[model samples]
Target: MKKVIIIGAGLAGSYLATQLPQNYDITIITKASAQDSNSMLAQGGIAASLDPGDNPASHEADTLAAGQHRNKVAAVDQLVHEGPKLIQTLIKQGMPFDHQANGALDFGLEGAHSHHRILHAKGDRTGLALTTFVQSQIEHVHWQENTTAVELLVKNGTCYGVRVRHDPTGTFKTLTADAVVLATGGLGNLFPLTTNDATITGDGIAIAARAGAKMADMAFMQFHPTLLSLHGKCFGLISEAVRGAGAILVDENNTPIMAAVPKKDLAPRDVVARHLTWWRAAGHQTFLDISAIPDFPKRFPGITANLDRHHVPFRTTNRIPIQPGAHFMMGGVQADLAAQTSIKRLFAIGEVACNGVHGANRLASNSLLDCLVSAEEATKVIAALEPAVTPALPQDPTTIVPPKLPSLADLRQAAWHNLGVERTKAQLHDFHTWLAQFNYRDLVPTQLSPKDFTIANLCLCAELIDTAALKEPKSIGAHYIKEVAHESTAS
Candidate 1:
């Protein structure tokens, strides 16, 4: 049996494992337990044109529009054409989705959709439900929990395996395989306030870049406009479905923030996030006025539960205080439709890999769809690959001593201020200068602890985004740069 190693146990990795041929020996390595992922925290439903009024063409159009037409036409076409069938297959395979009283699949509406085709499972717990369903179906898989993949074991430009650290015990081990799959999620934790799970620290993308893999669209990080904010910190996300259901974003004076913006509450994520950021910068507190949405507790039970846990008086006031938080990364290790990166035998799926399907900004709930479609395509290609052959790995002649790096807290805070929402050239340049102090762009440290490895990975990925942002000074999509702001301020 050919040995296949999969990094990450989230929806992408877990679902990919089940789809791979039974002949392959599969092992899944994750930084935390399977449940601790952005996948499990996802409340947004999956997007598919399941209704009679909806079609793949329309779905593709909406995706392109949301991505600001920056999406790869071919990849978007494939996702739209193939996603519905895959979703239906999952439904037939006992994937429990919410159904109406008429027993029809209950699809919800979200931002940037031309049709009501966002399929949710168990109300607002779609991510948790989907993760549970896929994980329960995985069999004949080896799981390495509490472990971190520190480096890719590549020889002669071909990936054979990975060097991982067991986080708890601090022991290192090399797991060799015929092909390596990177399903690790995005670098949301790079920002101080994010909707991402703490485990998502850009490890996979960092390791890939260090292994000489090509990266793309590294500057387009999406900020969700409605994370529940208390004091100055964000706690949980208020799904876009809430706005689709009838809630409106309002300032402290009860004036609708999006009233003047095109598409208003239904605008693409980038627009809404930018507007929210500007509104806040102008000294206004933003919130989601939920009074228009009837039966909020029933419609958003999960969000309601979290609000209650956080001691918010949403039940009485019908308003949810909100702010934009770094929610998704539209840029990552560049991969193709088959989830193959530029490097051979290295496949990337889910948020970790960018195929231009999401373009510069992701449509609501298309994330789960991308995870499904790409994983299925990757399985077909991986099954046809030959067995692994252990090759002699090269060792570096010089080892640089570790430099004093910023604390993870400090690093996250810096990234949030410098790289968040609207970035200026001055901010990017200064952030790049500070990050240059501990550059690991060329070296993947094997001598560091797991925590240091994470910090190193974050630093490397931050530089990648900083460089990419500096290269493109023009504002486009989620990579909005206030060049004039910097120029005027500098002068």
Candidate 2:
């Protein structure tokens, strides 16, 4: 049997492991605990065309609209069409979704959606509930936690395996496999203040890019408009679903700023984020006010509990201060609908693969749905491939110790200053130059440490983002250019 080594034990990797033929030897590697992924922090429900009155066509239209005409029509169609079936599979695998009195799945609304087709579990803890359920059922798969993949092992233009750093053993090892799937999630943590987990540092995207895989649309990063600003290593996310449920974006004086926009509170995330940015620059603090919402606790129990744990009462506080933070990357290892990358034996899914389903901007709740549909499709493709000869594992060196690399704090600062919610041609050009200099001068060639590998990957991914953003002259979606006089005048 051919062995498949999956990197990043998030929803895509874990769910893909289950779908692959059990006969294949599958090992999932995670940087932290199994649940330590951005997926677990996803409070909004999965977007699915499950309602009897709704269908894939409607979902596809909404997704394309949000993507600003940059999404591939066929990819969007496949994702929307495959979404409900995958949701059903999750339900069968013990994912408990909210149900109405008649035993039908209860749906919630989010920004840019034409229908209330988002399926949730327990108010707003859908991602946690789903992750918990999936982990419980995935008993047969081999799990290597506290391990990070440093580089791809490619030979003769084909991917063979991975070079990994096992933190617990304090050593490097090579894991050979017939096939490798990189599901390592987005680069949100690259910024100083983001809703993404600390582990989301673009490892998969960087490793694959270095291995010669083609990346696309990397400039189109999504900045979520409402992450809670807290002082520390951890911060909380205020769900965009709150806006979908009638919450208002207000300035310091509590005046509604987004009321003039189409869909009002339900406008796409880019519009909402820009409004907040403008307000903040105009010497006013911005916040999302959900105080007037009648069923606030019932609709968002997870958020309420999280806020209560921090001693902030939702009912008493009139507004929650927020700003745009890096939330999702719409581009990554360019892939087809089957999740197969340019490389023959390599595949990518979830946030790491730019399957063209999201285009320039992702619709709310579409991320979880993308994970399900792409994972299912990729599993089928991987199962059909012929097994290849396993390559020999790389040996760990004992003679020399690798030098220390920059801290996560340094990386966050660099990314935020250059690649956050807004951009400019001059800033991006300078960033690219700095990155090229760092790579050529600082990074060592051999005996690389985990931190060294991670920082290198981050620099590569950041360069791609900066390069792509510099090329795209228009302000669209979550990506905005400060110097552009008008969005129409750009590009």
**TM-score list, all predictions:** 0.96, 0.93
State which candidate has the highest TM-score: 1
Model 2, 401: alpha-carbon shift in Å? 11
Q: Estimate the overall C-alpha local distance difference test score of candidate 1.
A: 0.88
Among all candidates shown, the one with the greatest lDDT: 1
Name the TM-score of candidate 1: 0.96
Counting only residues 3 or more apart in sequence or on different chains, how many pairs clash (N, Cα, C under 3 Å) in candidate 2? 0
Q: What are the per-residue Cα lDDT tens digits for candidate 1 across 79-138?
A: 999999988888889999999999988889988888999999878999999989999999
Model 2 residue 215 lDDT score: 94
Task: Give each model's whole-structure lDDT.
Answer: 0.88, 0.82
